[model samples]
Target: MNDQRPIVIIVFVFIISAVLLTKLFMIQVLDDSFLKRAERNAIQRVVDHPYRGLVYDRNGKLLVYNNPIFDLMIVPKEFQVKDTTRFLEIFGITKEHLIETYQAARKYSYVKPSTFIKQISTNEFARIQDFLIDYPGLFIMTRSVRSYPEPVAAHALGYIGEISGRQLERDSSGYYVQGDYVGLSGMERYYEDQMRGKKGVKYKMVNVRGVDKGPFKDGEYDTASVAGKNINSSIDMELQKYGEMLMKGKTGSVVAIEPKTGEILSMISAPFYDPNSLTGSDFGKSYTALNRLETKPLFNRPIMATYPPGSIFKIVQSLIGLQEGVLTPETTFACNRSLVACHNHPSPVNLFGAIRNSCNPYYHQAFRQIINQEVSSNTYKDTEIGLDIWREHVMKFGLGGTLGIDMPNEKGGDVPSSKYYDRFYGNGRWKYSTIYSLSIGQGELLVTPVQMANLAAIFANKGYYYTPHLIRAIDGDQSKIPQEYLTKHDVGVDAHHFDMVQDAMVQALFGTAQRALMKDIQIAGKTGTAQNPHGEDHSVFIAFAPKDNPKIAIAVYVENAGWGGRAAASMASLMIEKYLKDSVSRSDLEKYVIEGKFMN
Candidate 1:
C-alpha cells in the first residue's frame, strides 16, 4: 500500500509539470492575445477623422464647408488635476459638470479615452490649448463642423450630430465608434457614404499618465485618412436665395426645377432657421427650441407636406381627358353651378375656355365620363374599374407618389387607389358620386410641392421628365451622376395631346392667373385654391416660363392665403423671372408677397 501511494504521488507530480510546461509554452509563443492586451495598456490608439466633403452650387459657388473644431478627450484611469477650480474655470465648465463627465468616461472605460467637452471652437481651443498639458489625462482631438456661407437652404444642406445608440447598433461596417458624428438629414444623410470620408487609425506611445509621448514606431503602424469627395449640387444659389427672400413672413413652400434636366433650382420652406443655428455647441438647445415651435421650422415642406392639387390638377385632368378620348378640344360644358360650386365664369365654354376660367362643372362632368366608361354592367363595378384606370394615368404624371429626389424622408403623397377607397368605403359599396370631390383634385388626391414642380416640368417637356435631383456631379465628374437621374420617365401621353393642354394653360394665365403674366418671357400657368378645414384656403400655383422653350418650371403654395393669384401666382412668376433674367422687374409684386399683404 505504501509503494502504491508513492507511485500515485509521482504520477500526480508529472501531470502538474506537463500542465505548467504547456501554459508556459502558450504564454511564451503559442498565443499573442495577452501580449496584444498588454500593448494596449502601454500605447494609446487615436482615431484620425477625415475632413468632410465640401458642397458647392452648380456654378462652382461654395455653399457648405468644414470649420476646424476640437474635442477634449480624457482617460479616467490617468486623469488628475491639482487645482480643480482652476481647471473648471479654464474649460468654462462647472465642477458638477466636470465630475459628471468624468464619471461617464469612467463608466465607458478606465484606460480608453472618451469625449469630455465637444465642438470647441478654434478661438476657444487656442485660448485653452496650453492649459490642457497641465491635465495629464486630457488631450485635444481635432474635428470639423459644417459651416454655411449664407443662411439659405437650411433643409437642403442639413446638419451632423453624434451617432445615436440605434445607429451604432445598425452600423454593419464597424467604422463608427462611440464619439463619431453622422449626417442626420437632407443631403447630408442622403449622401453620407460620399460625404463622411474614411476614418484612419494612429498609434502613439504614452506614459502611465495617458500623455502622448510621440508617434509609436515613427508612424510605421499608422494609416492615412482619405478626405471625403466634394459634391457639386444642381441648385442655383442666386435663384434659391431669391426664392427664399420672396417667401419670408409666409407659411408654405416653393420648388423650382430646370425643365431640360430635371435639376432642382430652388426648394424653400418658409419659417426656416439659419443652418448655423444647428451647428456648434448650441445645437442641442437650438434644435430643441426649433422642434417645440408651433410653426415646425424643421419640417421640409416641399417634400414632406401633402395638399390637394386644387385647380392646378385641372390641367392634369385635361390631359387625361384628352388621352382617354373622353373629351376633345371642342368639347363644351355649361357653367352649371348645380354640378359643383364654382366661381362666376362664361357659360357653355369649350375645353380651352374651361381651363382658362377653371370651370368646376366642366371638370366635374369630365371626371364622371372618365369614371363611368361602361366597363361593367353594374354601375358600382364600372366606377371602380374606371377609377383604378384613372389612378394609373395620374401616377404616370408623377402625382400621388414620391418623385425619388436626392433627399431623405420624402413623403409620397397619397394618390388613393381603388384599393385605398375600398378600405375606406368598403369594396363595391361606393361609386363615383360618393368620391366626386376628386373631380377637381380636392378629394383624397394629394401631392407634394416638389411633385407639383415635376408636373410642370412634364408639361414643359410635353410628355416626359427626368427624375429630379440635387447633385449634378461628384469630385468634378459629371459621369458619376446616378443612372436613374439621367433616365427619362415618359407619361405615356401622346405629344399632340400636350399641344392642346399647353395652349389651354397659356390661356389660363390670361384669365385667373393674370398676375403671373410676363412681358417678354411668355408665361403659361394655372392657379389653385385648396380648401383648408383648419384655416383659410391654401393658395397654390404651377407655372413655366418662355412657353416656347421653358427654362424653369415652378410650383408655389401659400398656406391660409385665400386666393391663389394673390400670393402663389406672384411668387411663381418672380421665381421664373429671377431664374431666366437673373433679376426681377416687378418690385411692387415682390413687396406685396414678402410683406404678407397678399392676404389682406
Candidate 2:
C-alpha cells in the first residue's frame, strides 16, 4: 500500500511539470512581439556618408575640395553625461546651448541620434576625443565641408547645403537622409548625381562603455563608400581670373566663349563674393550678408540680365536682308539726319561702310524690306509675316529663348513674335515703319551677355556652334550633348554675308572703335551704347580676335560706362590680347582699361 501511494505522487508531479513546459513553448515560439522589440532596442544601424567628388578646372586644377570637419552627435537613449560642464568645455559650447540641444535631441526621438554641435575644428575634435570618457553615447562624426582652392567662380561652382524636406519627398531612394549635403546652384546643382557619390554602410559594435570594439561580423556586411566622380570644367582659370580683375569695381558681366567649341572660357559677374564665405561654421551668416548686399553680387549677370542689343541687332537685320535677296552687300542706303523725315541722306553708303558707321537709316531701310517679303507667294499678305521671318532668323542665332547652356537658372531674353505684335498693334494693322526702332536693337528686343557671346561664337564658327557648356567631362569621360541640342539651324544668310559682316566689324575697330585696337593685333569688334530707361547708357562691346583662326570671342558690358569704345571696348581688347597671345600687346591699353573711370 505504501509503494502504490509513492507511485501516485510521482505521477501527479510529472503532470504539473508537463503543463509548465507547454506554457513556456507557447510564449517563446508562438508569440514573438516582445522579443522582436528587445532585439531592436539593442541593435543600432548607422549610416556612413561617402566623400563628395572634387571639381577641377580644364587644366585639372582643383577648384572645389573637401575639408574634414567633426560634428558632435548625441544618442539620447544611451546618453549618460557624468560631467556636463566638462563636456561643454571640451565642445566649446555654452551650458545653455547644451541644454537646448539636449532638449531638441530628446524631442526628435530618444532612440534616434541628432547633431548637437556642428563644424568643430580639428583641434576641437581632438580635445573632445580626449574627454569622451566622461560622456557616454555622445560621439564624434567626421563630415566634410566644401573648401574652395581659388575662391573665385562662386556662381559657377556654386555651393552645397543640407537637403531640404521638400527634396527628401521628391527623392526617396534613401539616397539622402538627415544632414546630407546637396548642390544648390550652378554646375553643382545641374550635376548633383554625378557629383554626389554613392553612400556606403558599415555595422560597428560597441562595448558597454561606449567605446567602439571593432567591426561587426568581421566587416562582412560593410560597404566601401564610392567617392563622387571628378568633374573637369571648361573654364580657363587664367582667363576667368583676368576677366574678374578687369571687372573690378564695375557692375556688369563679361562672358568669353571659345568660338570653335562653344566652351565658356571666362564668365564674370561683377560684385562677386568669395566662395569660401559660404562654407564651414559661418555659412549661414555669410549667405545672409551676400543676400543683403546692395549690388546683388550673387546674381549671375551673364544669363540673368537682359538688355537691348542696340547696334548689335543691326548685324542680324543686315544678314536677314541679304538672305531674303532684299539687299545686296553693295546695296547702298543714304542716312538722313532728320528724325521725322525719311528723305535726309543723299550720300549713298555700301553695306560695309554703313555697318562701320552704324547707320541707323540703312538698317531701317533693310528692316522695311524684310517686313514686305512674303513667307510664301500664296501665304497671307500680313506685314507680321516678314517680321516673323526676321524673328526666325534672329532665333536661329540662339536669341529670344533659352540657349540651353549647362548653367542653372539662365533667362531666355525676350524675342517678341508676330502674335505679340498682333496684341500690341492689332491684327495686320501695323507696318514695319511702326517698329523701325527694331533695326537699331530697341523697343522690346532684349538679349543677355551669354546670348551676345553665343552670337559672336556663331560668327566665329562661320555657321554652327556647339551648345555652350561649362562641364567638359565627368571622371575623364566627355559629356554627351543631348540630341535636341545637336541640330544646327541656319541664320538664313549665305557664306558671303558673314564675310561682309566680318569685314565691316573689322572696319569698325579701325574706324569707330580705333581706341580699342591693341598694337600688333587686329581686333574685330562693335561698340554699343545702349540707352537705359532707368539711368545712363550701358556701354557694351562684342569682339573676337586675331580675326583669322579666332581663339576667343567675348562680350563685355559695363553699366553706365558711357560709350562702348571707352571702358567696355578697352576691356574686351585687353582680355582678348591677354588670352590669345598670353600678354597684352599694349601695356598702355591695359593700364587704360584697368584705371578707366566711368561717369555715372
Candidate 3:
C-alpha cells in the first residue's frame, strides 16, 4: 500500500537465489542427484504384486483393506550395511537384529532379493526413508499389508502371508513366484483366485549406486498392475462386533444366518484376536503367542467343535418321529421320570407340551416309538431300520456333516451310524433302550455350531434351507457365489409338520428360555443344557426372530455354563434384539452377558 512492491521483489529474488545456489552446490559437489540420470544405468526388473482385494461388510463398512507398507529387501551380495552404529541408529533396530536378519536373508538367497525386514508401517518408514539413499545393497520395495480397524473377525476374515514352499510347488496356475502373498483362510482363502489379481513387472533403469534413473526402454518393457476385485460380503459388521463383545470372557461361539438366503450375518469364535496385530513386523511373535494360548484362540469352535446338541436335538427327533408317522401332534407321553430323570414338571404332556417343556422322558418315549415301530419282523430289526431312516432324515438338515460353508478345514461333524454302534456296542447287542440317551440328544452324536445354525434356518424356512454360507457375492454381484449355495436343500419331512414345531419353539421362549424372548419380536427358540461327562454341563441355544418372515437365525454354545437360559439364550436374545432394532432395549441383560463370567 505504501509503494513497497519493488523492495519486496528485490529481497525475495536475493533470498531465493542464495538458497538455490547453496542447494546446487550440495547436489553438484557433495552428492549426485541428477548425475545418476545423466549416466544411464542397467535396467532392474521388479515384480509388482497387485494390491489384494478390499473386503467390505454388507452395508459397505470396510472390514479389511490394503495399507501401504515398505519392505526392506536386500540382495546379500550387492547389499552392504557398513557403519554398524549408523545402520542401527538409522533403522531404529539393535545390532543383533540386523545381523540375524541379514544371516537369515542370506540363507534364502545371496544374489536374489529377499525381504530383510517386512511390514514396516508407512508412518515409521516416512521418518527414515529420506535417509535410505545413504545406504547401499538394500532397496525399499512397495507392498500392501492387511489392516483391520475393529479386529473383530480374525477367523472369519483370515490374514495373508508369504507363499510357503509346499504352496509354491502346488500352485498349478504358475502365477506365484517367490515372495508372493496369498490368502490363507476364511473368505480370503475361499476366493483366493479372484481376490488376488494378476501381478505385473516393471523394468526400471538404475545406476550402480542402486538409484533409479527412469523407466527401462522408455516404459516399453513394463506392464501395469491391476488392483484386485473388491469383495462385498454378507457379514453385518455391527452385529458381528456386538456378538464378539457378548462372547468376551467366555469360551464358545455364536453364528447367525439369514433364514432365506443363507447369507451368514455373523460368525464369532471367542478368544479372537485383532486382525491388525498379525500384519506388522510382529506377525511371527503374535502367531507364537496365540499358538501358546491355553484357551486355543486359534481353534474355530463354531464350524469345528463337536458336542452333544442336548435338548436342541429334540427338535430333530420330533421331526423324524413326525416323518416316520409313529408320532403325531395328539401323541402324549408321561413325564413320570420312570425311564430318565426330570425336574418335576407336569406329566402326560402332548407333543407340543413335550417340546415346550423339553421333557426328557417324553422324548425318550417318543424316540422309542420311532425306533421300535415294527415295520420289520422283530423289534430289534425294526429298531435298526428306524434308526437308519432317522439318520437319513436328520442328514437332510445338514447335520452330522459339513454345511459346505466357505471356510477351510471345516469339520463335517459326526452322527453315529450302525457301524459306529457295532464297533462300540457290538451290532446285535444294542437297541433303542441301550441307546435311549440319544433320544435326548446325548451319547455319541456330535454336531458343529454351523450345522446347528443351518437347522434353525431349515425350521425358519419350513422344511427347506439354503446352505449357511459366509459369502453373499463377489465384486458386488450376488451371482458369483457357488450354485449349490443358492439351491434349496429340503428335508424329507412335510412342510405342514414344521408349523407345530415352530409353535412349540416359540412356546419354549415363554417357558424354558423366557430370558431369550424379546418384547415386540416373537422369537422362536430351544434351550440345550448338554451333558459334559468330565465337568459341568454346557449351555446351548438356537433361535430365530420375528417368527414370520424371519430375518436372523442364531445359535450359541457356552462351555461350562449352568444352563442355556443363563448364558447362551441370554446372549442370543441380545443379538436378535440388536439386529432387528439396530439398538438394544435390554441394557441390563446386555451388561450381564458382557460382564458376567460364565465359566470357571
Candidate 4:
C-alpha cells in the first residue's frame, strides 16, 4: 500500500508537470498565434466603411447622396498629443473636452483606433492635415455622411446612425461592428444589406508613434470596399414636394399609387423635418429635438397612423352587396334618418344614388342584409356565417392588415372578425344592430393612408390590386424587386360588379364631391368624414384619374378637417391634374390647396 501510494504521488506530479510543459510549448513554440497577436501591437486595422447606396427618384433625379466628412482618429498608444493647444484650436474643442475625450478613447482601447472628434468639415480637415503628420498618434479618417438635396420624402428615405450594442448582437450577418452606421428606418432599413454594401478590411503597418507606414506587405492582405448598390425609388420627387406643400401646417398623411403597378408615387406625412437635419454633426441634437416634440414629426403617418376609413369604405359595402346578390344598382332603401341619420339628400336612393349622395341609411340596411341574409334557419348562426363571409371577401381587398410595404414598423390596420366580437360580446350574444356602425364604414374598420390608397387602386383596376410598394427597382434591375410586388392580387368580386361601383363613384362628383371635378380629365372619387372621439372629425378622400387606363390612385386624410369634400377631395383632384396634364390648369384651385384655405 505504501509503495502504491508513493507511485500515485509521483504520477500526479508528472501529470501536472506534463500539462504545464505542453501548454508552455504550445504558447511559446508550437503555435505562432500568440506571437502573431503580439505583432498586432505595431499593426493598425483601419476599418473601411463602404459608401452607402445613393437614392434616386424614378426619373433619375438624385435624392440622397454622400458628402465627405472627417473624423480625427487616435490610437491611445500611438497618440502623443505633442501640442495640446494646437490640437484643441484646430478641432475647436476646449481643454476639458480633450482630457475627457482622450481618456474615453483609451478606455475604448489601448491599441485600437477610436474616433476622437467626428464630422469635421472639409475646411477644418484641410487646415489640420498638414500639422496632422507632426502628431504621429493622431490622423484623419475620411468618412461619408448622407446628404439630401431636395429635402423631400423625409420619412420615406430614412436615415443612418451609429450601430448600437443591441444591433451588433442581432447582426447575425456579422457585417457590422462598433462605430458602424446602420439604417434606422424607412427604405434604408428595408434594404440595409444592399445599401450598406460589403465592408472591406485593409491591414496597414504602423509605427509606435501611430504614423501610418504604407500598406503592409505591399497591400497583399488589403481589400477594397465595394460601394453599396444604388436604389431607384418609385417616388415622383416633384409630386412628392407638391403633396408636402399642400399638407403643410396640418397633421395628416397622403399616399399615391400607380394602380396597374402598385408603385408608390408620393407618400407624405405632414409636419416633416428636413432629412438633412438628421445627418452629419447635428444628427444627435436634431434627432433628440424632433423626437421630443408632441406632434411627433418623426412619426410616419402614411403607414403607421390608423383611423376609421370613413364613408369611402361604403365602396367595399357596395361591392360586397353586389357580389353576394343582396343588392342591385336599382335596389333602393329609404333614408328616414332614424336607423342611422345621414345628410339629407333624397328620400329613397337606389344603390347607385346612395353611393353618389353618401347616404348612411342605404348602407345601414344593406350591411344588415349582408350579415343577416337567409343562409341558415337559425338567425344567430346565419348572422355569424354571413359576417364571416363578408370579412373574407374584404381581406381580398388588402384591408384589415398590413399591405406588407417595404418599410419598417408598418402597422396592420384593424378589421374585427367573429372571434373579436365573440371575445367582446360573448357567444351568440351580439346581433346585427349591435355592430350596425360598421355599415357606414365606421366602428372597427380602421385603415392607414397607404391602405386607403390601395383601396383606391382596387377600384381603379375593377376587382384586383397590386400590393403597394415604394421600391421600383433595385441594383438598377427591376427584377431585383420582390416577386410578390410583380404578382397581381385579385379581390374575388366579379369584374362587372366593379363596373356598377365605378359608375356610381364617378357620379359622386355631381352629388357629394362636386368640387373634386377635374376639367376634361375624368375622375372617380369618394369623400369621407370620419367621426373622431378625441377631436374634430377627420376628412378623407380616395380617387384615381382618366377613368379607364388610370395612371394614378391616391388617398388623402386631413386631421381635424371638418369635411372630406373641403380638404381631402380637393387635394386628390389637384394631384391627379398635375400627374395627367403635367401642369395644373386650375391655378385658383391649386392656390386654395397650397394655401390651406380648406383646412380653416
lDDT of each: 0.90, 0.80, 0.85, 0.88
CA shift at 138, candidate 4, in angstroms? Answer: 2.0
Score candidate 2 by TM-score against the native.
Answer: 0.91
Off by over 4 Å in 3: 1-41, 93-110, 597-600
| lDDT score at residue 582, model 1, on the 0-100 scale | 88
TM-scores for all candidates? 0.93, 0.91, 0.90, 0.92
Off by over 4 Å in 2: 1-43, 340-347, 374-381, 479-489
Q: Per-residue CA lDDT of candidate 2, range 9-48, in tens?
A: 9999999989998888877999887776664554455667
Candidate No. with top TM-score: 1
Candidate 3: C-alpha RMSD to true structure equals 12.9
lDDT (tens digit, per residue) of candidate 4 on 229-274: 9999999999998888888888899999999999999999988989
Q: In model 1, how many backbone clashes occur?
A: 0
What would you estimate as the lDDT of candidate 1?
0.90
In candidate 1, which residue pairs clash?
Answer: none
The residue-by-residue lDDT of candidate 1 on 188-274, one tens digit each, is 999899999998889998777666789988999999899999999988899989988988878999999999999998889987889
